[model samples]
Structures are given as C-alpha cells and as structure tokens.
Target: MQLKQALASAVERLDAADVGSPRMNAEVLLLFVIGADRAYLYAHPERELTSEEAARYEEVLAQRATGMPSQYITGHQEFWGLDFVVSPAVLIPRPETEHLVEAVLELARGVQRPKLVDVGTGSGCIALALAHELPDAEVYAVDLSAEALEIARANAARLQLDKRVRFLQCNVLDPVWEKTPDVIPSEDFSPSRGTCCSEFRDFDFVVSNPPYVAFSEADKVQKSVREFEPTMAVFAGLHGIDVIVPLVEQAHLALKPGGWLALEMGYSMREEVVNLLSPTMWEDIRVVPDLQGIPRVVAARKQ
Candidate 1:
C-alpha cells in the first residue's frame, strides 16, 4: 500500500480506538516500520511499502488500537534527550522525570565525585542519566523487582554506561547497608544506625521518581499505563505517598550532613511532601515546577 494511504487508514483506526495522538502515533509507527524518517515520509508521499513492511505496520497499529503504549510497541522511549529501551517489565521513562535528573545535576554541580543513589530505580533512567552526565560520580541504582533491574541493566549496557552504574535488586536503598535488617529501621536512628544496618554512608544525594499514584487513582491513568506498565512502578498505596513518606526519612539518614535529596513528586502532594521535610531535619527545601508550573520536584538538604 502507498505510504500516505496506509497512514490515513492507520489514523482512522487509532481514532476509532480513541487512542490519544492518533495522527502522531500513526506517523511514528509507520516511520518505524519503513525504516524512514518523518522528512522522508513527506518527500516520498507516494512511496509504496513492501508486503512485509505493510504487514508489520498493520500489526503495530492493531496493538496500539488496544491501548498498548507506543513506547512499548517500539521498545524505546526518550528521556533527557536520550533514547531508552523500554518494556512492560519497566516503567516507560516519562518526560517529566527528566526534571529529577536536572534537579540532581544542578544540586551536585559543586560536589566532587559525589556518591549518589536512586531509589526504586526501575529502568535505571535517573541513575544512568546522572552517571552519563557526571562521569566522575559514583552511582548506585536500587529496585525491588529483578525483572525491572534486568531492564535497567540492559539500558545501562546499551548506552555504554554499564561500568558507570551499579544495579542492586533490593527494596530501595536498604541494600546499601552492611547488614540491612528485614524491616527498615526507625527514622530516628540511635546513632548506632550503621551498627545494625548498612555501613554505606554519606551519600551526596539520594534521588527518586517513586510510585505516586494511589490504588484508587489507578483508574484515572490511561488504559496502557494501567494495563501494561508495571503496577508497583505506578501505584504506591492508599495515599500514593506510601513510598515518598518513607523516602524522606531514608534520604535524610542516607545523605551527608549537608547533602541533598531530590524527588519527583505528584503535583497535588507538594504540601504533604513539604510537611514531610520539616525544618528540623531538612533545610533549603525547594519545590521545582515543570514547564506548566506544576510543582513537580521537591528538593531538600539534610540539616
């Protein structure tokens, strides 16, 4: 079939499926199938697809019609201007999460060879991105799901950042300790914290884009997001701050005296997060908004 005609049909099908960004999705999938770029599509509007290419494009379109994310179909997503391999095993990296990386880079600017850790580092996007940008820094990525860690490891290797970041399959930063207990210790550590837990200490920063969607809010997400993406990477608990609440305490214990903790939080939970990082344990608390001025990132320095 001719390129223009095929794309027209694909768009109509996607629109009927109620897929968002139908035209753009159709064009991207077609381009992916034909091994061509958007400019080439315009220049060769009369181009005819080979039988195999036509079949493959149709298959992708059918998949999209079911609300499978295009990123999963293409096995890739772009974040911080870099293309990342993505799959159902890991959360597809979002553009908003780039702000997490930006906030980290900005805070770590003056720190030399900083020790950094990313909690719940699903695709290793935040950690790998930081390691790529800060070659001298020591980077650690932690996740609870082995499948997710595998994806993260694959991405690190694909980006030629394999040696730059360490991947650990554990619950958050708990693996960093010398002898991490089964349960997370109390927030108000006894100063003898390291004696019972990890000896790893003095992190320059602990960053994360943790799960912030509540179970009840799950239905509010797109069908693809709810059905395809890893659920633990999306939903936290009843309040969606299940992870964030603990993260604030963990980050404080994990960072150096003046180190920073940066997190990408839900826009509506800004005040709750701010309250979590009260003046006693945290200082220099800042909430960074994305392009739309939504409070997207909450950063604080350990006092």
Candidate 2:
C-alpha cells in the first residue's frame, strides 16, 4: 500500500483503540518503521512501503494499540538532545525530568570535577546527561534492579559515555557505607542518612527522580505509562513519600557540606517535601516548577 494510505489507516486504528494523539502517534510510528523523519514522511507520502516495512509498521501499531509507549516500541528516547536506548526494564525519560538536569548543570558550573551520584538511575538518563555535559565531573549511578542497569549500560555505551558514567547495582535506601566503604565511611555517616540500613557515601551533588506516585494514584496515570512501564519506577507508598523521605534524609549525609540535593516530586507534593526535610539539615530548600509551571523539582543544600 502507499505510505499515505497506510498512515491514514494506522491513525484510524489508533483512534478507534482510544489512543490519545492518534494522528501524531501514527506519524511517529511510520517514521520509525521507514527510518525517516517527519519531513521525509510528508515529502514521500506516495512512496511505496516494501513488504518488510509494512510488516514492521503493523507490529508497532499493534503494540501501540495496547498502550505500550512509543519510545519503548521504537527502543529509543531522546532526552536533552541525545538519544538513549529504552526498554521495558527502565522508565522512559520524560520532558519534566529535563528540569532536574538543568538545575544540576547550572549549580555545577563553578565546581571543578564535582562528584555526582544519581539515585535510582533508571536507564541512567540523568547521570549520563550530566556526565555528557560536565565531562570533568565524576558521575556515578545506582539502581536496585540489574535488568535496568543493563539497559542503562547500553545507553551509556551508545552515547559513548561508558567511561564517564559508572553504574552500580545498589539500593539507595540501604546504608551504603558498610558495602562501599571506599566511597562512604561509617564514621563520617550522619544519623539523618535515612535508617542507615544500607551502606553507600559522600557525593558533591545527589539528584533523583525517585518513584513518587502513590499507589492510589496509579489508575490516574496515562495508559501508556501504567500498562507498559515498570511499576517499581512509578508508585511509592501510601503518601508517595516512602522513597522520597528516605532519600532526602540520606541525601543530606551523602552530599558534601554545602552540596546540593535535587529531587523531582509529584506536582502536588512540593510543600510536603519541603516540610519533611529539617531546616537545620538542608538550607535554601525550595521548589522549582517545570516548563508547564507546575511545582516539580525540590532542591536543597546540605548544611
């Protein structure tokens, strides 16, 4: 079939399946199948689809109809102007997380070779992006799931940042000092570093987009996210602060004196997050809004 005809049919199918933004999704899927950009797709609407290309398009459309994210179907996502490989193992990079990266880069400008760590570095998006922009810094990433780390490692290599960013299989909730003494020490560890059940330690800056969606809010997420993405990367406890609270308390101990901790929270949890951290432990605790003007990132400095 002609490319235009196939594109029209795909859009109709997606619409009937209740996929939001059907036309745009169809265009993007077509671009992926044909290995062409939007402009190319438009310019060559009459171009005939080979049998293999048609088959691939059909397969992708089928997945899309089931609410699988387009990025996962395409096996790639673009963030901060760079492309990263994505899979079901990791959370797809979101535009809102760009604010976290920007805030970190802005703060790192004056520091030399700043030691930075990304907690819950799903797909190593934030860590790799920071390392790519700040080549002088020592960037480290940690995630609890090994499968997620595999995708993250592949993404780092694809971006040629393997040497700059390091990925470790570790849980941020556990006290890291006992397991990784070389990085964090027991004596230097602060009492406020969460429950101190896990060991790990000092970084110049700590940033994360930890799981903040409450279990009750799961059904409210877009079908593309709730149905296909990993749930471990999405929902937290009843208040959605189960992870964030521990991270905030521990991040204070993990960061160097005056170092910054940047966190991405649910749009409505800014005030609660600010109130959770003690003023004595973190100075200049404030929330920054995302591009949509919703309060999204909360940043503070270790005193």
Which candidate leads in TM-score? Answer: 1
- Write down the lDDT that model 2 would get: 0.84
Location of the lowest summed lDDT over 10 successive residues in candidate 1: 182-191
Cα lDDT of candidate 1 equals 0.86
lDDT of 2 at 35: 91
Error of 2 at 233 (Å): 0.3
Tens digits of per-residue lDDT for model 1 on 1-303? 899999999999999999999999999999989988999999999989999999999899999898999989988898877778888989999888998899889988888999998989888899988998999998878777889888888899899998778666667666444666653332223355443245346899999999999888877887788999998999999889889887887788888899999999887989888999979999999899999999999999999
Error of 2 at 94 (Å): 0.3
Clashes of each: 3, 9
Residue by residue across 1-303, what tens digits does model 2's lDDT show?
999999999999999999989999999999999998988878888999999999999999999999888888888898999998899999999989999999999888899989888999998899999999998998878777778888988888899998787666666635444454324322223566443334245678999999999988877888778878898898888778888887887787778799999989998997899998788788988788987899988889899
Error of 2 at 103 (Å): 0.7
